[model samples]
Target: MGERILIAFNRTRERTVAAKTRVADTPASRAVGLLGRDGLGPEEGLWIVPCAMIHTVGMRFPIDVLFLDREGRVRRVISDLKPWRLSPWVWAAHSVLELAGGTLRGSVQAGDRIEFDG
Candidate 1:
């Protein structure tokens, strides 16, 4: 398991703990997103509660990235991410999460809150 990190963005209700300490995924707590070389969609979204890293050590397909706040709200959502792409520098990000291709499959949206265990 990756190191957990706690974070709360903007007008969130509380703080969240990330399972993975992906520092490069987040630059701050406002601008949270992913680095997409391909195209990401709702099918490849992740449901990370507090924080986590979607590490692609040896995987295929693109993934959509989502940035969640404390209120379980989505701060930012980027889609169609291929491979070998670096996430942009976000200034206001509470936490970061990653998922496999077509994994989300129309499950999450804006103003949605999720739970995670650290």
Candidate 2:
């Protein structure tokens, strides 16, 4: 809840994936990710490091999930995942990026590189 970091997806020709992304690097932060929140904005996202699978057990809205490797390259992408849905386990993923529903519908794709900007 402090300062947010900017994120960009290199493979997308339309727009940036997320303009303000919050890093959930800690266990506590990762565990409480996006739960009980109203909704995710178009330009907001959550980056969960060291994560491969996630369950939207108590989520209020749908979201787009991207599984990425250690180098910030996307390995898999799930768009418009409804609440209570469970994501498939991506063995090659070193992290997970959660964003607003339909965020990656026609924008992002697998193998795209992601970067954090100041």
Candidate 3:
């Protein structure tokens, strides 16, 4: 796991989506994201910085992805992204949040704002 942080969704009444989000800011951490992990906990997530795309080539489970811009505004959301799949490049995104599958169904969406707290 990386540095733990809290993720809050501002648009949804300041709801806390992820309370144990990890930061993957380094090259090594980003490349090895979620690999070898069985699955993510209910409130667990990974935040990859300076990323525009992601893949689950050898992953064992599905996830929900949030593409965020520099100001922490969500540009796109991909839900239930299964293993062995690749995500489309988000040109305006500056980071990405990978959460457990079904986590974003009604709690988050595109155009939302995200807040990170250490």
Winner by TM-score:
3
lDDT of 1: 0.46
Candidate 3: clashing pairs of residues: none
Per-model lDDT:
0.46, 0.86, 0.89
Clashes of 1: 14
Q: What is the lDDT of candidate 2?
A: 0.86
Off by over 4 Å in 3: 8-12
Q: Estimate each model's TM-score.
A: 0.45, 0.90, 0.92
lDDT of each residue in 20-87, candidate 3, tens digit only: 89888999889999999999998899999989999999999999999999998999999999999999
Tens digits of per-residue lDDT, candidate 1, 23-106, equal 333333213333433433432333443453344323356665666665546656666556655556444446655655554455
Mark the 10 consecutive residues where model 2 has the least summed lDDT: 6-15
Q: Which stretches of candidate 2 lie over 4 Å from their true place?
A: 1-4, 11-15
The order of the candidates by TM-score, greatest first, is 3, 2, 1
Worst 10 residues of 3 by lDDT: 4-13
How close to the true structure is residue 109 of candidate 2, measured as C-alpha lDDT?
78
Better structure of 1 and 2 per lDDT: 2
State the displacement of the C-alpha of residue 59, model 3, in Å, after optimal TM-score superposition. Answer: 0.3
